[model samples]
Target: MPAIVHFEVRIDPERRDEAAKYLAETLAATRAWPGNQGIEALVDDADPCHILVVETWATTQDHDDYAAWRTTPEGKSSLGEILAAPPSKQVYSETLPLGL
Candidate 1:
């Protein structure tokens, strides 16, 4: 089954717009990455400095591979110095719906 990954990042208030633009420019590559089903970038309404990236991957290993690539120099170069704190990530699986 596909996995859902939540990535949360806190950007400096002054750099929030830059951060959003960066995501917009870079996420197409992410969406094109292997095993990536899709991704959605969201910002907190009450806290614009907070950003959330929801990603769907074909499997956990695929997400792990993507993460490994992100640590490379090329990947690091693509992501400018926009984060106020290290990004946080969590992986989740869908729960079966309860029958009424």
Candidate 2:
């Protein structure tokens, strides 16, 4: 089953456009292992400083691999300026009770 990965980042309001542009380019250029599906980014309407990135992958392994890459010095160097603070994140597996 695919996994849903949620990413939340808080960026300086004044830097909103810059943050979005950075994310857009980064994700576009990112390459992942097999089983990677797609990614979507959302900006909070009520809070311009808050941004969310939702990603779907064919399995947890793909997400793990991508995450490991993000922690590397090269990765940090690329994304360092776009962040106002550390990002908040979570992962989930979809479930339907009663086979629904």
Residue lDDT tens for model 2, 1-100: 8998898888876677788678876776443446668888898899888888888888888788778876787654354476789888898877778874
What lDDT does each candidate get? 0.83, 0.76
Per-residue C-alpha lDDT of model 1 across residues 20-90, encoded as one tens digit per residue: 67887778778888999999988899988888999999998888898888888766534447888888999
Which residue pairs in candidate 1 collide? none
What lDDT score goes with residue 68 in model 1?
A: 89
After the best TM-score superposition of candidate 1, give how far the Cα of residue 69 lies from its true spot, in angstroms. Answer: 1.0
Clashes of each: 0, 0
Runs in model 1 deviating more than 4 A are 77-80, 94-100
Model 1 misses residue 96 by how many Å?
5.6
Candidate 1 worst ten-residue window by lDDT: 73-82
